[model samples]
Target chain A: MKPAPFAYAKARSVEDAIALLAQHGEGAKLLAGGQSLIATLNMRLSAPRILIDLNGIAGLNSITLKGGEVEIGAMTRHAEIERSDVIRKHAPLIAMAMPHIAHPAIRNRGTIGGSIAFADPAAELPACLLALGGLVEIAGPKGKRTVKADDYFKGLYETAIGACDMLTGIRLPAAPAASRYGFAELSRRHGDYAVAGLAASATFASGKLTKVRLAFFGVDLTPVRAKAAEMALAGGDLDKAVAALASDLDPPDDIQENGAVKKHLAGVLLRRVVQQLTETRA
Target chain B: MNEMCDISLTVNGERVSERVEARKSLVDFLRDDLTLTGSHVGCEHGVCGACTVRVNGEIVRGCLMLAVQCDGASVETIEGVSDSGEIADLQEAFQKRNALQCGFCTPGMLLTAQDLLSNDQTPSRDHIREHISGNYCRCTGYHAIVDAVESVAQARKGSRK
Candidate 1:
């Protein structure tokens, strides 16, 4: 019930935070929202010699929609994203998936970059970002770099973010005018981690789908991009996409669900999301 | 050994300053240091909402947040919200509907339900249930709790009319 003790430092600026990270390396952990980090700390699953609290940095919590893209800072809370009209207007797919992350209390403190940086296989933000074709910005002792969503996530609880790097911002190309999205997940309880989840976004132009992207979470080592399904569903009906998932995915059994059941739920969610895209025509 | 931090904040409208360990949870700080025992500790990992409280006008899991993070922030616990008479009607509604059995989860439940009603003037039954999904109520089956919330909403609406 108690976390191992660690020294705490607050970063008033990005450079200061990165300096601390470089100094401590893997021995230090950045406290973003603390929704996920503190939980691991309390359970003794993670112990670090230093905690770099990023909340004191003033500019990292802004969400900007400009130049045909949406840029969300790393410290932006889930609750802020859920209620931001700018997010809803620019990237509705991410907005659609916000409530599924956790309840409002948790959302008020949990952060978007933290979720992506943690890279939980069961999380919704990672899959949603994958479906949005998002990019992650990283800052470290070597300075700044940008990684595409496809390259950002590495594996279970692992990311391209270096131990001495801090995820600074998430960037997404603006959803096209005709882009319609559907996000759904199967969890025993509403706010619990999903047993299986799906997020799909596509442009419906001239009664046909274009730029189709489907991402599934809680069914693999990382959020999976169903490219085969996307290819099959482009300019065609959703049943093809739903059926293609069977071939595209083969997740192993986990504590909450057997592999077969998870596959079934994933298929079910795909159908619902595709139906959603159809019912809510662009 | 843990590093100690000194933090100052307004709790229930009172400005208080204290020196706490860097690793001390907000819930433990309030309960042990300040003797504000209204908020309970159930699952310290932020799943269960038993330690819910308002920090800078938003409800958060107190157990998941460290006291040092709350420096200069405003926190409102169940004890504060109850004493402020802000949720008098909600407390009465809970009693009328028998929303609790053992009462261990009552305080957190009230604060959670209060948050829902404050944000929504008219939330559906499904919405109420959805909002409190994080708060675990081991007794009362949640039917009475939902009813109490629904009842308060209706009363507020009637009074508005």
Candidate 2:
């Protein structure tokens, strides 16, 4: 199906992109990898009048490590991020979840910033970023500002990013020593959007669980951080803590499953993550 | 509204410059404008890998990309996977193993497999399955499809001294 007609503007730099967006306002859309936007456009679900292409922008494709945090450029492709040794060593959860994102073809073109900006609740990267306490760097016509992962996501396919703002990069804190990562999702098939998914990171300090971050996707309007569950496991044993965490979660219903079923699956998966963490620590 | 956008792209190792609409998809530009129909458009959405093509050495869905988005990129379709007019090992294996029935999914499957084999010469059965998971086939149930890829991996390993 042919997409609705739109104006194409090639952005030479971050400032140019922001200016084009500001000029077009809500009628303008930034084209990064175009994995999500193009699809929505072809379906006529979104009809932006001007597409500000950011492919020509320099330095937006870099993946660098500095200040004890991994700063990934918004244009960095999923395949590149998946294959980065630095990302693997420092952010293994993102690496582990990369393959589960669509397939090799999509990963080759899909960008981390594009995924986050698209804000699909079912996508693995956003939930993984939330679990790692990441931050998004945005460039606007006025200036730049950073948004924390916890506060960035607003709702289904919605983010705090304004129409005149472009997500330039994302910063992920390095995982602490003794951190055990677990990512699990249930999809009808490989490359299919997950029906239900969970990503978890648990940090142990001196034989005690010091911090636990649990995030779930495909179960709510946004990739939700299970704060209640995190509180339940703050200073408890893995098994007992996961049990309490399970009781604290209330998953929503969707086309995949009913609310009761999702809640049950969330409990079962949380138990699996805790069990895996226990074994890794043991 | 009547102005045409000038797009310059290297397709299948050949440089081509064409005037296209701002909203024209890369798949349309390849199949209709540039006359490279190797990249098929199946679902017209990102879900189906039938429109898969390699842009700047990375496999991407052509249906989910604008022609202008690829202004300065290099694209490779199934036709470019082989230069000597001989079927590549993966393609030969697919035929030998009867991996294709209707053949509509062959081009996309071949392109996807090429991407996988380029990265992992010795992919496990599970790895191969994960590689082509995005390209769905309505026929054959994927048993022979996986076997075909495994056959190539085995042959490639055997030839590596």
Candidate 3:
């Protein structure tokens, strides 16, 4: 299990990586964590001529909390996010979603930016980011620009990140004190990709639900927010929101599940999560 | 055809530098170049944890990473950690618990179990199962392996107090 022959360069900075990408274009692939890239390379699925290794770039893995937002460097490992008290405090949604990522070993090497760039429909990170209305920072030839999570993920194995660009970091607005989060996924195995999953956050002022956001995975080309359900849940009537999911999500039919089955699981998860959110903290 | 990359790393507390093929995985580098054959390459796709090893104190899939990417990194394979007697009690517990039947999965299992012990000397049984979920052991049905790791964790916790 070796990759196809390719020249490797340890990128010193974002400028260096961007220059190499601009030089090689599609022939170059940025290697971060290498969890997905190397496996794809070894399987002969993709053969980029040059790999711009991003591991050498310093400060790409910093986790910063400022301006009531959590900005995580794109190269930060999943384990770091899982263990970061900053994430657990400021954005509990991300902290809640980390364990649902692959196992601890994979978490040790897999980067959140790589997962976001990969845009796996079944993965949990994208959906969590979507649920939290997070943003991604991309450094391209022009300069750095932030894209909302909603506009970031284009489709399966796709994102707004360009061939000559690199995802530098992720920005998550601080969750409010009144906000409560819930995440659940049903997979055949614990570490396996979920069959159907949902992540959600809802804010309550006094006893009235003011805002609710839900994102479902393994149901569409990208992690899709159930906008209809979110609107319906604003009134705190979970049954109405659960019913609205049927219209908000149009699930894909795969060998493991039909569209109807995924929709059903989505509703089941919505019910469980809504109950968890409304209940007292554990 | 090959493109060689120069990389330096500390493996088993020893500084090593070499020119390796850019495509060569860290597992192959450990096994073929340095002859540290303890880390096996199974399911080389990162699904199976047979190639699990410590890179800069974190367990990672050796097969999923290229040796060239590990420049100036510290890698500790089963050979180094085992030789240091760091996980001897866990190993003995595995032996007493019969965690392996065929022994092909033992190296990865031991390393994975040691990873859990190092992190939390008192991890829950479910935590043990969750941590090693990626390390597939098709032979033992996982009961014995969990038993071995859990026994070691409890024993170690008991001794610490």
Candidate 4:
């Protein structure tokens, strides 16, 4: 497999990248880690007129704690997030789910922004962001704007990022005191895309679960928040929570598995995650 | 906009300058232009680990990267590292254990194995398997491969002692 002939431009800054995007409009594709983009190019699934390489743009690869959130630059690689003590302390779900993203080699070059912007239904980062109540920062010709994680993801491979916009960074709220994190996924292989997965965050308060958020991926067009299941769990009805998944998620049949099978797996994951989170307290 | 660009990067240890198509993959550049065929081309879509290599000190899928994107970067392939004797111990261990049968996936397997050993000297069997899970070995079924890597890790620890 080989990519079609295309021109390449390396942007020196985010503004430069935006300018390049503005110039090319929909004809150009922004290259972050190139892990997924390059593959699409090689398969000729995508043939952009020009590739605007964002790797040369500085300041998009830093991980910092600002105010009450952990700010991760869009160009930040997955491996960096896996080892970052700040993430491990502040956004542990992202850290905990890092190894499942891919193998060591792929993680070395794949960027957090790429994963989020690509918006793969089976991806871990987007689901983690949703569970953590994170935010995505997008930059366009009119300047920068922030989109809530709840509003950022639209559909399969579709995001709030417009043709002339670029995702600059993502900010995850600092973990609350006594908050517990639970993350697990099932795949044919460890690094393959998940058959079904769950990322949940909840605060254990006085023998009761409060502010519980369960984000399930590989079970919908986008990472879905299981509010019904969360409500059931918060009300102390574990059986109801599991049963509520039928109303919460309606996964479509994919090449890997059937929709009914995916719904069943999602229920299984909810139980396991709840058990794991509660077990940590004892 | 030019479809071809000039790039000057270090391959192995020597600096090389050339003009390549922007669409050309780094693995193809190495195998065709530099004659460093140690890194084989399997599935070009980043699934198969047949084209694993090092760029700027970290391992990446060679096919997932474009040669033009590696401008000014330092790259290392199996041939380069093998010639430098960096993975000599791993090579010997693989030979002794018969970890490779077809040898098509050996280059990527060795690079991935060395990557794990260099990072953690005492990786568990499960951890080793997880780390190299991306590299598909169709023949060995991975039992012998894991054995070889584990033995080398123990030997390196012994040498240190």
In TM-score terms, which candidate is top?
Answer: 4
- Candidate 3, residues A39-133, lDDT tens digits: the string is 89989899999899888889989888999899999999999999899998998988888988888888989998888888889999999989888
- Write the candidate numbers in order of decreasing DockQ: 4, 1, 2, 3
Docking class of 2: medium
Candidate number with greatest lDDT: 4
Better of 3 and 4 by lDDT: 4
lDDT of 3 by residue, B1-161 (tens): 13788889999999999999999999999999999998988888989899999999888999899998888999999999889999899889888988988877788888888888888878888999998898888889999999999998888888989
* Per-model TM-score of chain B: 0.97, 0.93, 0.96, 0.98
Q: Rank the candidates by lDDT, best first.
A: 4, 1, 3, 2
DockQ of each: 0.70, 0.69, 0.65, 0.92
Q: Pairing residues by index, what is the TM-score of model 2?
A: 0.94
Cα lDDT tens digits, model 4, B33-55, are 99999899999988889999999
For residues B70-112, could you state the per-residue lDDT of candidate 1 as single tens digits? 9999999999998999999999999998998888888888988
How does candidate 4 fare on TM-score?
A: 0.99
- Over the stretch B1-161, how does candidate 2's per-residue lDDT look in tens digits? 22269878898889989999998998899999878787888988888788888888888888988887788889888888766443388888888999999888888888888777778989999998888888978987988999998888788789896
Instruction: Report clash pairs, candidate 1.
Output: none
How high is the DockQ of candidate 1? Answer: 0.70
Candidate 4 segments exceeding 4 Å error: none
Please give each candidate's TM-score. 0.97, 0.94, 0.96, 0.99
A126: Cα error in model 1, Å: 0.7
Model 1 clash number: 0
Candidate 2 chain A, poorest ten consecutive residues by summed lDDT:
A237-246
